[model samples]
Target: MVNLTDLLTDLAAESADVDSLVAPLSAGDWASPTPAPGWTIGHQIAHLAWTDHVALLAATDVDAFFASVTTAPDPARLVDVGAEEFLAPPDELLPRWRAGRAALAAALAAAPPGEKLPWYGTGMSPASMVTARIMETWAHGEDVADALGVTRPATARLRHVAYLGFRTLRHSFAAHGREVPTAPVRVELAAPDGATWSYGPEDAADRVTGPARDFCLLVTQRRHRADLALTATGPVADAWLDVAQAFAGPPGAGREPLSTRDTTVSEVTA
Candidate 1:
């Protein structure tokens, strides 16, 4: 069985990191735009805070959580609802976010084993729930970091995110109303600590090999597949790169593949 303790620990650390990084931002900074298209820094934080609160409810009191949620008439616009609902002065939003995240970390860590928690699109085990939270933190943290001109380095915690990405391949495919291919594809990633982390069967013909940071970036929709140095083989595997998403939701419009121009051989072969 997967250990939820380690996953929760990592999530807590990552959450704290995000909190510290965003703590220094001024009202002007929070109003700045992020890499997430039209979403501003405040919007990003509000989204995280709102989701954190919901996750806490799911972990601790599933019935109340369900009862408390008011479904929007338009489901597609639901993501926008949280931002609008949480719109407040920076001081108010910040404290709500801080409380929400802390509550989430505590609730998730205390969840009983074998319990399934409802999430955006599917139910998640405590381990999967925490991993998904960590993935969200790192993904949005990247955008927040980018807005602040800070480079967030990759960490071994990515092993869990990569695990989630590979595990969700079928979901990603199915979300598009397409059938998932059964043949396994190899995922060989170069971890930052000079170690190789791999997924899928060793004998599988399909393969995706690249730096770990790049793979995480690709799965999170933080970078277009073309922007990263990853190689895929086999038609199924090759096509998967065109639409890879870790976090669950509607089939996302993956970022556009960028031009392979002014590029070096190392960039391709690395």
Candidate 2:
């Protein structure tokens, strides 16, 4: 059984990891552009805070959360709009994000058992919600790390991200307007501590094998498949690498490979 407490704890640690990255930054660093097009470090945190607040609403007040969805100015640009609306000076935005994530943790912990929290186009259990939070935190943290030219070691927290990525395979295909593959795809990843993390069937013909970090990067759309050392066997697995996405939204224009990029920083479609 999935343990909410464990997932929540990992979520806290993931948030703290990102917080540590930003907390030491000077005011000017907050404006540093990340890999995400048009999004600064500040915008990344703002987006996290905004999403946490919205998630908190989903957990505690379903009506209000849905109301915000219906009233959004631009559904397509909702993520950008949320980040923009919550963007602030470092001192202010930092605290806001910290408090919001903490509150979201508390709210998710106290949610009724098996209750599904309404999200963008679907609903999620509190555990799943927290897992998604961890995934997003790691992904955006990657952006922040890239902006600062810092290398973050892969941790066990990547398990949550990898799992979410594997689970969202169908959503990825649907988001790209492609027919979802019916074949099972096995994912075998080498974890950070030299352990293996396997998902899907043991005998599945379609399989993806690689370092866990690379798979997470691919699913989060943080890096292109060509940049990663992942091996995909079978046609379904091969096609998946091109369109894989762990996020809930339209197909993201992912980053270009290093050799193809005009500048040092890889350009990603907003």
Candidate 3:
């Protein structure tokens, strides 16, 4: 069982980690493009800030959240619209994001035990909400890092992300208009610290195994499967990799693989 306190703590850490990456940036640096098509580093942070705000509403004010949803701009471009609307100057944006996330943590901590918060497509317990936030923080942080040509070290927080990915298998299939498979798929990943993290039935015929970082990248649609070292054994597992999405949304247009031919030519030229 996930402890609400623990998940909230991890959520804070994940948010802080991303904060550290953006805090020192010059205004111009915020304009750097990320792997997410058309999203700059500013858009990435703005999206996080906006999400945290709405998540706060879900946790504390149900009616307002529902109203916001009902009145929201196009569902398809809502994410992009939110990012644009919430964007601000770095100094102002940084403090707002920091304060808002802190308030969200406090709200979640005080939420009634077993209280289900309204969210897009589903309701979430406080713990589950925090876990989703962590996943988003890390995933968007990956975009920010990529924009700046920085690398982030993988940590055990990936366990939360991996767990969410595993749990969302059905959503992945359904969003893609495929039949949700009843077959259990096992996932075994090598953690950053050389430990093994396993999920699903030991006897399950479908399985995915790989580095935890790669698995997180795959499920978050941060990288193309071809660029990762994950191995999917059996048909369900193989097909799942093609459409897996950790976050709730329509099927993402995942990043394209780095072309081997282009890479070789660049290498030769250098």
Best by TM-score: 2
Report the lDDT tens digits of candidate 3 across residue range 1-270: 678899998998999899999999999999877766667788888899999999999999999999988898686778888888889989888888899899999999999879999988889999889999999999999888877878999999999999999999999999889999999999999999999999999999999999999999888988779999999999999999998998886787776677643221110000
User: TM-scores of all models?
Assistant: 0.91, 0.97, 0.95
- lDDT of predicted model 2: 0.91
RMSD each, Å? 4.8, 1.4, 4.5
Candidate 1: where are CA atoms >4 Å away?
68-70, 257-270
Order of the predicted models by lDDT, top scorer first: 2, 3, 1
Between 1 and 3, whose lDDT is larger? 3
Clash count for candidate 3 is: 0
Per candidate, the number of residue pairs that clash is 0, 0, 0
lDDT of every model, 2 decimals: 0.78, 0.91, 0.87
Error of 2 at 245 (Å): 0.7
Top candidate, metric lDDT: 2
Clashing pairs in 2: none
Tell me which of candidates 1 and 2 scores higher on lDDT: 2
Tens digit per residue, CA lDDT, model 1, 143-205: 788778788878888888888888878877887788788888899999999999999899999
